[model samples]
Target chain A: MRATVIHAPFDVRLEELPDPRIEGPGDAVVKVVASCICGSDLWPYRGDPPVKQPRPIGHEFVGIVQEVGFDVRTVKPGDFVVAPFVVSDGTCPHCLAGYQTACQNLVGYGQGKADGGQGEYVKLPYADGTLVATPEVPDDALVPSLLTLSDVMGTGWHAARSARVKAGDTVVVVGDGAVGLCGVLAASRMGAERVVALSRHEPRQKLAKEFGATDIISERGDAAKDAVLELTKGVGADAVLECVGTAQSMTTAFDVARPGATVGFVGVPHGVEVPISTMFRNNIGLAGGAAPCRAYLPALMADVLSGAIDPGKVFDSELPLADVAEGYAAMHERRAIKVLLRP
Target chain B: MRATVIHAPFDVRLEELPDPRIEGPGDAVVKVVASCICGSDLWPYRGDPPVKQPRPIGHEFVGIVQEVGFDVRTVKPGDFVVAPFVVSDGTCPHCLAGYQTACQNLVGYGQGKADGGQGEYVKLPYADGTLVATPEVPDDALVPSLLTLSDVMGTGWHAARSARVKAGDTVVVVGDGAVGLCGVLAASRMGAERVVALSRHEPRQKLAKEFGATDIISERGDAAKDAVLELTKGVGADAVLECVGTAQSMTTAFDVARPGATVGFVGVPHGVEVPISTMFRNNIGLAGGAAPCRAYLPALMADVLSGAIDPGKVFDSELPLADVAEGYAAMHERRAIKVLLRP
Candidate 1:
């Protein structure tokens, strides 16, 4: 099997690796049907110091079970499924409570013993808990959308769900990346009356609109807040979905939210400290984290199979698994909102 | 008129002052019938610099209106009412949305201009909005209970309401002060099946039990959290109310809350910065701010009038306004759960 590995900064390469096999009683070996690069993956590709040594990369994937361990019962060989970015025991208290990200018995792929999902064959732990089977093998065209269920789309959905986006809500999405675009879609699906996307890029703005943005604000920070206030007739938005984790983005989310409104943030936060005084004065509610993608996958996958939504429009580029390097470069250079890889 | 003044640290005195008179069209002068010192008022009494000198003190009061400005319509002369700690216009967007604390035209009393509540007479701003008229003036025995409505009890209610404490939910309160006792009461009223009160003091623990604490923990920090985990069979409580503003209190709130639980905090926060990464990973929801007490006033007053609840039991000590210094000392020295001041 060929796998993508980031050996150093900007050094992504396709390296041949031995095929994976089921090791634990609860594990299964999956033949990767499709996989994709993620925003966080760029951390190492862009030289984040913590990711030091060469390692198989990519956490999001849609695959078919080729073999299952003796103890596996929920899924079987030939079953097409979506694997969330994190593997969690379905029976844990946190998992049962719909917070799989905090499940005590949790594991991450592309780590140590687990085979990276970008490869042709990946070993999946807690297969019954991490994988959600589709109604049947989805069509090739539907694969892209189903694969997003592994991370980005569900990540975006978590932001909206956390903010409690309700019918007739005026929601603000404060980013234009794939996650933010998906927020527009999620807010729309949640019955929000108006969805505003903040973006300065022309192409991204168009994509945001396509994903269900009722309005687009090209301005950033204070100006973006002003636009939101004006759009809501001086009454700030009902919910602010922060898909960008920067300090400025979080600030904008608070600034544009009406008093008593919630600001749901799902981006990997950096240098963000919630101004306690501000949150206190406004009765603002803040929720969202590394999305419990496994918790949201079942519903989102159903939406995809029934053709109720089109989250796959985010994938603007595609390549065979061998050209994984090009996929990384395209995403890093902002040439594609998302890159789909065929294994 | 006599008013309680904190001229300096340990310099509380009963000072003679002119009787308050309406100064604005939205103001009304009230002859204070009952007043009390809040836990926060002790900050300056103990030498916290932000609370400055030579000012009339106390923001919690229940009074009888003496006169109303020409523009005041909702409240009139001769009405017995309760004033929220913060004054807000009843017509603002935030006020209309039940977030009076964040109203655009907000005003705070007890500092300057607005005559302090712990006085013979207080010049109330936004009289129509800030003051809630009871069905009728009550007997002396109920005065202390109604006075609690002005701040501490309302603050506790805010914590429970913010945490969304519901039927059969297990609620943990972090702080055993007046507000924490009030939280136990509020949670019980909100239908919580069990309430855990954290307090080391025997008197406060007794008060907590009276207010409906199903359990009590004398431990603080990690041990307290361990007690809570042990109580809940390691699943954590459904809601955790943080009534202590210390960093440790906030941390304990998170440490003892279930993954999907909310931490409703009402204590004046100091040095409490929520670790966003931890909150995110646990999908922990953080809500609560200055208790929108005015928004809660009507419902609470209705309950108070109907005898459905009595929040006044938190006032355990009584002192004449002239002995305000001793009142502050009693609270500071942990000799009293709360001090009631008579003007």
Candidate 2:
């Protein structure tokens, strides 16, 4: 089998690797049909997070099951499925509460020593809970959309749920990345009357508009807050989805929220300092973290299967597995919203 | 009128001041029977805040109505009442939502030209919303308990409500000052089965036990978190009330709380960096601030009126108005649980 591996900074290579086998009784091997580069993947590629050993590079994918271990019951060979980034037992208290990302015995796919979805074949643990099967094999075009259910889509759903987004809400999404764009779509699907996207890129902003953004604010700082405030008639947004993990983005989300509104932060907080005083005084609720991807994938897959939301639109560029390095480079330079890879 | 005034750090004086009058349509004048020193008062008195002018001191009080403006309707002259620290309009949007402390026209009782309860007579604005009437005027012994209802008791109630304390909850309260001690009472009243108080002061810890603290952790750092976790069988606390407004206190509160719990913080946050990443990852909810004093005073007053709870037990020191400076000094030096001054 062939897989993408990172040797060092800005160096990605598709090399021959041994085919993954089912090591645990609950594990299953999947022949990858499609995989995609994720924003989080850039972390190790940019030399930001030290990578002493060559590591598996992706987590988002849709594939066909090739083999299953003895204890696996829900999934079998020939089954088409989406594998969430995090693997959970599906029976833990946290997993039962729909927070599988925080499951006590959770396994992080991409960061673990275990092989991830970026390869021609990958090993998925806790197959019954980590993989959601589609009723039928999706078409070539629908593969991209189905592949997104593995991560970005589920994360966007988590953002909406954390914010308690509901009908008639004026939601403000902070970020123009794939997750941010999906957040706009999720907010709209959740019945938000208005969705505002804050972006600088022309193409991403246009895609955001198509994905249900009723307003766009290209400005940053006080100007951005003023734009959202003005759009919501000075009361600020009813729900703010912070998709960028920076102090400036979190502050903007807090500043643009109404007194009783909620700020859902799904962005992995990079260097953020949340002002506890401001949040307390305004009674604003802050909720969100790593999306319980496994918990939300089933429903998100149903939505995608029913064609209610086109989350696949986030894949602005598609390439063969051999060009995986370009995908990482493009995402690092903010040139691609998301890159889909055919295995 | 004779009142306590702080001219500078450690420079409190009992000086002659003009008697308060009904200056507005919604105003009332009360002849203060008792007033007390609060921990927050030390912020300015300790020279942490800029002081360009002599400031009237004290915000908590219980008194007898001496005069009322033309529009005052809730109470009449000669009626005994408890004045909440915050004076709100009561009809604003925020007030209607049970957040009167953030009322559009909210006013803090003292610290500027605003006269405080330390005077013989104090002016009360928005009296219809600020003062809670008692069933009858009680003897001098009941004065201390009733006075606490004005701020400390009500503040603790706000903390409990913010933390969403419920029956049988395992609660932890950080800070053993009057507010934290009162929080023990409040959480107990709210039906918590296990109440833990984090304090190093033996006297305060003893008072906390008397006020319904089932456990106490005197150690700081990892030991405190370990103590709380050990008490909860490694699950941590269901609810935590942060009553001290400092970075260290806030960190301890967060560290001691379990996943999916709420950390209610009524402390005026000072130099606290709210770590949102940990909060989101741990699924902890943050609620509380400034204690919507007026909103909870009515219920606390009822407890005092019916003798259901003796909030006045927190007043460990009492002095005449002539010794008002000593009262402030006692609280500033942490020598008093709470200081009561007779006008």
Tell me how each candidate scores on DockQ against the true complex.
0.80, 0.40
Candidate 2 Cα misplacement greater than 4 A, ranges: A90-98, A111-113, A133-146, A166-168, A189-193, A280-285, A306-308, B72-79, B91-93, B111-113, B134-146, B164-168, B191-193, B298-310
Runs in model 1 with CA error above 4 Å?
B50-53, B111-113
Deviation from native of the Cα of residue A175 in model 2, angstroms: 1.6
Cα-based lDDT for every prediction: 0.88, 0.85
* Per-residue lDDT over B32-110 for candidate 2, one digit per residue giving the tens place of the 0 to 100 score: 8998888888888898896678878778888899999899999889999988887788877667756777777878766
Candidate 2 positional error at B209, Å: 3.4
lDDT of 2 by residue, A1-343 (tens): 9999888989989989888888889888999999999898888888888778887778888899999989988888999989887777887756776767767778776565357678899886788877888887777777888888888988887788778799998899998898999899999999999999999889988999989999999999899999987887666788889898898999999999887667888888888988777877887767778888777777788888788888999998989999999888988988888999998
User: How much is A316 displaced in model 1, in angstroms?
Assistant: 0.9
Root mean square deviation (Cα) for candidate 1: 1.8
| Cα lDDT of model 1 by residue, B1-343, tens digit | 9988878887788889887777889889989888888888888887786545488888999889899989998888888998888888889888999998888888878656588878889997788888988877787888888888888889999999989899999999999998999999999999999999999999889989988999999998899989999999999999999999889999999999988889998988889988787788787888888888887888888888788888888888998877888988899988988988887
Native contacts retained, all candidates in order:
0.83, 0.38
